[model samples]
Target: MKLSDYAKSQGISYRTAWHWWKQGLLKGHQLPNGTIIIDVDSSNHIRETACIYVRVPSVEDQDDLDRQANRLTEIALAKGYGVKRVVKEVASGLNDHRKQLISLLKNADYTVLMIANKDHLTLFGSDYLIILLDQLGKKVEIIEDINNQSEDLVPEFMAALRIFSQKIYGKSMTKLQVSHLLSEFQKQFAPEEH
Candidate 1:
C-alpha cells in the first residue's frame, strides 16, 4: 500500500513514517506515479547506500510511464536486487540538466539502473554510461524501447484519420493514400509557433 495509507492505517502521521524510514525501520519503493509502497519485510535489507535512479521524459507522461516502469521493476526484483532509494525526474533527451542528472549518476552503491534509451544512458555523455556500466559490475540490460511502444496509439489514430478523410472525400480511403494526404495536410497546417 501507499506510504500515506500505511501510515494512516497504523495511526501515525506521514512525517513519522518518514522518520521511521530514515532510521531503517520502514522500506518503500517510489512508483512512477509518485506513490510509495512500503513492505515490512523489504525494510530488512535497508543499507546506508543502496539505491536506484529512473529518468523519464516528462512528469506529464507519468500516466503513460506506469506500465513500462512496472515491467522494468519486475525484472529487477526477480534478479534479487536490493533497491533502497529511487530518483524520478521529468527530463527530456534534448534538453536536460547535465549537472543535476550527474549528481545522481555517480552513485557507487546501486547495482542496477533501468533506462529507456541510449539517450538516458548518455545523460552525462558516451563516457558516462560506459563508466557506470563498468562500475556497477553487472551487465546493463537495455529494456524494450518504451518510447517506441508508447507511440502505438499513432497507428490507431492514423486509421481513424483515414476513416474521417474517406467521409470527407465521399469515397473509400486506402492506407497508403490516406497517409500521403495526411502528410500533406500536416505540412500545410502544422501548428504555428507563438
Candidate 2:
C-alpha cells in the first residue's frame, strides 16, 4: 500500500504516518525513487471479503452446486477473506426469473461476489449481469472458468419461443397475439414492473 493509502486506512494524517514509520511503529519502506510504501499484513490481517453464489441447471445437480459453493467458500476463507454467505440455486443460467440470484445481486451486505465463472451467473449474456452488479457496487471474482455447456441452446430456444406465435398459432395477421405474448414475456422476466 502507498503511504497515503495506509494513512487513510489508519485514519491518520500522512505526516503522522511518516512519523509512525520514522518511530518504528508502522512498517514501511522508502525506495530510491523516494516512493513511500507500507506493508499492511504483518499482524495476519485479512481484509478481503466475499459472498458465494452457486447455480446448477436442475434439481439432480444440487450436489454439484453444493460442492461449488463449498469450494468457493473455502477459497474465500483460505485467502483470509471474511466469508459472508453461501447461496445456492438450481436453475438455468439463461432463465431471467432467478429469485435467488436477483436477491443476491441486490444485497448490500457484500460487494465481492465469488463464483465459478460468468456462466454460473448468466449463460445468455453475463456481461449484462456484470454491468448490473457493478451498478449495485459489487464485482465478481471467478475462481474457475466454467464453460457454458448449453450456450448454443439458449439463443436457439429463445428464437424458437419468439417465433412460436407464427409457428404454433399460424397467425402473423394480428397485433393482439404479439402484444399478449410480449406482456407475458415481460411479466415472466420483469416482475418489478408489477
Top-scoring candidate (TM-score): 2
Residues 1-194 of candidate 1 have per-residue lDDT tens digits of 77787666544457756666566566767779977778756444322222344555555556545665556555554444444344555555434454545765665555556654454444336456657576767345566576575463344346457657778986766777978977887789989889
Residue pairs with backbone overlap in model 1? none
The residue-by-residue lDDT of candidate 2 on 1-194, one tens digit each, is 88888766543357756766787766778989988888878552335557889987666567777778778876875565556677898776656888998898777777689988677788767887788777877878887644554543443344345456567777663545565666687588975744
Q: Write down the TM-score for model 2.
A: 0.53
lDDT of 1 at 113: 61
Local distance difference test scores for all models: 0.56, 0.69
Give the distance in Å from residue 180's predicted Cα in candidate 1 to where it truly belongs: 18
Residue 75 of model 1, lDDT score: 59
When superposed on Cα atoms, how far off is each prediction in RMSD?
Answer: 14.0, 15.3
Return the TM-score for each candidate structure.
Answer: 0.44, 0.53
**Backbone clashes counted, model 1:** 0
